[model samples]
Target: MAKTKAAAENESQLADPSVDRKALLSEALRRRIVSMEMAPGAVVDELALSEEFGLSRPPVRELMRQMAAEGYIELEANRAARVSSMNHQSLRNFFLAAPLIYIATTQLAAIHATHAEIDELKAIQQRFREAIEQNDVENRVLYNDQFHLQIGKMAHNPYLMPSLRRILIDHARLGKIFYRHPTTHDMEADLGKAAGQHDQIIDAIARHDAQAAGDIVRAHMDLSRRRMTEYVAPVGVEVPLAF
Candidate 1:
């Protein structure tokens, strides 16, 4: 009876249903785009999405519009929509805005992330390790985000959370696609190195070393930049397709 009660109690502490649902839609679309499941430059079939989620067109359209506004999609002249294909210029702009925001956010989190939150982060990291083991690309993306967003919320800064959310959304799109035809050296494109870095960042946070936490994040971002350099188009050039 005690074990049963504990299990039920633990489930109750999970994310609120509404917030979880919104995040579900948001993260799914982001991963789909990045992995090219939605394919850059391909139309997003709103009707199909509405049917898939068992949602009415109105709410689904609203969500798609929100994503599009965030530069995740391109609405064509004829009113059709598809994932945006970032050329070198746009990708450059995206990466440039990310580091400044993410580092500051994680720094705040290290200072404020409670002991309970730290434990929660460790559990999420465990799941991430499992995902990496199974080579579950899509599931790995979700948990990859589960960890960072948890830290962002721990920062206790409401305004910073939204910006960090936006940054991860963009990063998810880039990193997943970037991995599809990743650097020749990696060959398999396994993100083991990046996943390992997550453990390092968690350690820094657990130690409550704010400067170390921020530095780890910088290294994390730099590693992503290096991994992505292979696919980065020339400045001012736009590619019609990405892997």
Candidate 2:
């Protein structure tokens, strides 16, 4: 009789609507941030979020605090929280730091990844491929972020994981611009190459080839950098005007 009552109580809790509101809000905010729906440096309105989520200000503030800690937003004294910014200096730093962090984390992941983590990476890659095929710019950026983040998790290094997380937050925001403007003649082909690199990365990690994994990750970062640069300032022929 006690076991029956306990099971019923567990089901009741599972059926409760309010319990998941916090998680729902968190996930919605995360998606928005990652997808660039909340632009970089945009101010986060706590009252607006509270109304949108149908929650009180306290929970909304708590959620903002949590995201702030996770590198998704910046909180300042006497100011509303703002989405993490990607200014020129920040982009310069990101370019300088990305390859090093990715290489180190990927090397460690190759050394320490488990079979389950590799499997998860494969699943994420599949989704990434689907996003490309469907022209889902947001999901492509998001799944790519997840792909690298899973690699970071596999690394299992406390010191490196936080760096990896910070790097990825900015990386995703930048990647949105790349995905949004697919101007290349062979955009699909470029995506296919990226997916192929992902496969190679997974294989190298599974084989515990740290050197090869590092090389692959560097190449991956280079590809992303090249693509982002193209969008930043496309080359054009100068036209002379009559003086």
Candidate 3:
């Protein structure tokens, strides 16, 4: 009876909505990387984290390996794990390559998306716009990335997804810097500008205008890259003020 009870408990935990160890660890690592809480090139103290999380070193190391594969961390000297650092050249390459890849997927989605998939993208955009107005830019970036990701999902190209996800996320992480800058020329005054572009993309897709959708998606990324180039490092990159 005791063994059966324990088995039931384990099964219940496995079915529990909140029970997702891999997801929890992955999200924790992603937040730390994106918020710069883990400084670029700083070594991750694996032993310390395992103690803090009450897990064995193996699980923590597994998390580190996942982040390293994602380009958020790297193996440093003698197999020491460290967060990845920024390089302007790599950022530029990502900016250039990401849009082309995403645009191509958007074209495919526009060609093939069902009405339901189109509606789902529209819904993601709607919630995204609301998050922006609420000054929940954090949530906005998350959902905004989802909006583009949905496009790729509708593309139905298994081979394209891995690269699409990598590039889009690199831009999403840079969103931390982009959101902080004052709009150089009234861009913030029109918070709707980004939303409008999203709507245009959706409309093009719904109309099955693949070429036009691709063009607008490209233009949106172009404007973002231009604005990001204007982002100054907020004066010396001191420990972020957020507690």
How are the candidates ranked when ordered by lDDT, highest leading? 2, 3, 1
| Per-residue lDDT over 1-243 for candidate 2, one digit per residue giving the tens place of the 0 to 100 score | 345443355346546765676776787777778778889999988887776556798988888888898889999999989999988888889999999999999999999999999999999999998988888887899899999999999999999988888899888888787767675766667778889999999999999999999999899989888877877778898998987
| Regions of candidate 3 where Cα sits further than 4 Å from its true position | 1-18, 77-79, 181-185, 189-191, 232-243
Best by TM-score: 2
For TM-score, candidate 2 versus 3, the one ahead is 2
Residues 133-184 of candidate 3: C-alpha lDDT, one tens digit per residue? 7877677777878898899998899988888877755667776667754345
Off by over 4 Å in 1: 1-31, 51-56, 69-71, 74-78, 181-190, 233-243
Which ranges of candidate 2 are over 4 A from the true structure?
1-16, 240-243
TM-score each candidate.
Answer: 0.73, 0.87, 0.79
Clashing pairs in 3: none
Give Cα-based local distance difference scores for all models: 0.74, 0.86, 0.77
